[model samples]
Target: MRWMQRTWIGSTITLALTMLFLTGCPKRPDVVETVPRPMAPQGEVGMPTPPPLPKVAIPEEKSPTEVAAQPSEAKPTTEAGAVPEAKIAEAEVKPEPSAEGKAAAEPELALKDIYFDYDQSAIREDSKKQLNENIEWLRKNLAGKVTIEGHCDERGSSEYNLALGERRARATRDYLTAAGIGADRISTISFGKERPFALGHDESAWKWNRRAHFTPSAK
Candidate 1:
């Protein structure tokens, strides 16, 4: 009986030990190794890299000779072609008058001297006809001015002849004025008996001396 009790105690002890070992030592779970994913190539996910800028071709600078070689646009011209400067100057120049023009420009024949009666300042009929012809000439040549020279015979005293001569000249001027000639165009001068048409002291010379001469002004 003692042995049986001992064997039973031994079997119980061994079984209890085995159960404790199984419970205390649990089986380990499977271990998984973590690998870090390669970092995405720089700038793939967050901010993307900008593409490179395109290149622009620049033109080369041209030389002076190349620029000059280019054809220039023609200038616009008028319908009437441009006249030469010399030709324009020649056209502006006035041509000299011909010989015929010069001859035509010559002054007309002088008016005939008017004879006055002795000791009289009044104009005679014959003298009036001559004066009218002179007036016509003056009218045609408006630019001409005349001086009337009065003369007297040597019969009177020097002072008296001078007075007579002046009276004669005034009478001639008045006649010209009344005949429509401008007074400003006519001037008077008394020669008295100093200058005579004829040098002789006879009546023929005296008749010629008592005259009014018409002299055109040079100016």
Candidate 2:
């Protein structure tokens, strides 16, 4: 009987000790269940994709003939007070010389003759006046050239008259050269007894024949 009682108390104590140890230990965390979200609608995951735009067709290029058929841009018209371009061009271009201008360009009068004493090459005092008049004309018309034609009376021999006439022409030319006329501008020529100014053998005829005449040349 005493042994039975001691076993029972010892067993009771052991069971109580086991219960206290289990109570002192830490508890484990509780487990939670996870649920998956419903899948998004087919096109709504991010931004909805825009529907494809309808394609537009480009027109073909026109032919050159079709382009030419189009109306041209209008040109500006001249104002009422404005002058035409053609008239302005004509006005800018100078007109040719008139009849009056042509007439004025030519020399108006001829030079006077210079008479000399019979068979003499010396220029007379009266002839000097004529030469002065010629000089004035020459100065005005600088381009003019002259030939000094010396003549003789029929009384002298042809050869002698020719030689004398040349002397007279040379003397006349020398006088002109001394008076500022260029030597190149004055030319001398002798028309002997073969060509006489007056037909008769009298002093009047000889006086007229023994003279120096001025003839203009173009050169």
Candidate 3:
């Protein structure tokens, strides 16, 4: 009985000492370690690439000579006051008409004496053409004044031939006035057998002597 009691006491003291030793010592905390990761390239190494943008055609720029070679809108060209060579020469030089040409143009204007039959005051058939020509001349020269001298053949008295000559002169004046000549532009005179164009006493001389002569004067 004494040996069992002593063994039980030793076992109880050893269990108590082991529990006190465990309670007296402090516990240690757990330690955590952080690991650094390696950096990757752009878009992660094996990412898919987007499709290339649709290719657009770009026009090339042209130089001055190349642009000028292209056809452009049509524009009207001007002479800029430049006269033609032919016109300049024509303006600078002109040829005057000759005196012979003047004579030709004025031949119709030369006043010709219109003859009458023996002791007649009426206009003769042959004298119509000559009278018309004289009227044309007077019309062309509007500023010309005319004197119609009436003549007679040497066959009557001085007073009687003068009356006849006056009749002839009046007849000539009437014809001229009726053909559009102004009466104010004409003057009448009697030269009854005083001035004879043909001196002989024949039909030719008498015909020439009995006439109306036109003398023109410029205004």
Q: Please give the range of 10 consecutive residues that has the lowest summed lDDT in model 2.
A: 102-111
lDDT of 3: 0.83
Tens digits of per-residue lDDT for model 2 on 1-219? 999999999999999998888888867879887889776665896856778789999898899999999999999999999999999999999788776675456543457788888778898898898899888888887988998888888886899999999999999989888989998898889988778878897996888898888888764
Per-residue lDDT tens digits of candidate 3, residues 2-99?
99998999989999998899889876777777667665644676755566699999999999999999999888765799887889899989887687
Across 149-202, the per-residue lDDT of candidate 1 in tens digits comes to 999999979999989998998999899899899998988899899998898888
Position 29, candidate 3: lDDT: 70
Superposition-based RMSD of candidate 3 using all C-alpha atoms, in angstroms:
25.4
Cα-lDDT of candidate 2: 0.85
Give the clashing pairs for model 3. none
Clash counts for all predictions: 0, 0, 0
Off by over 4 Å in 3: 1-109
- Pairs clashing in candidate 1? none
- The TM-score measured for candidate 2 stands at 0.51
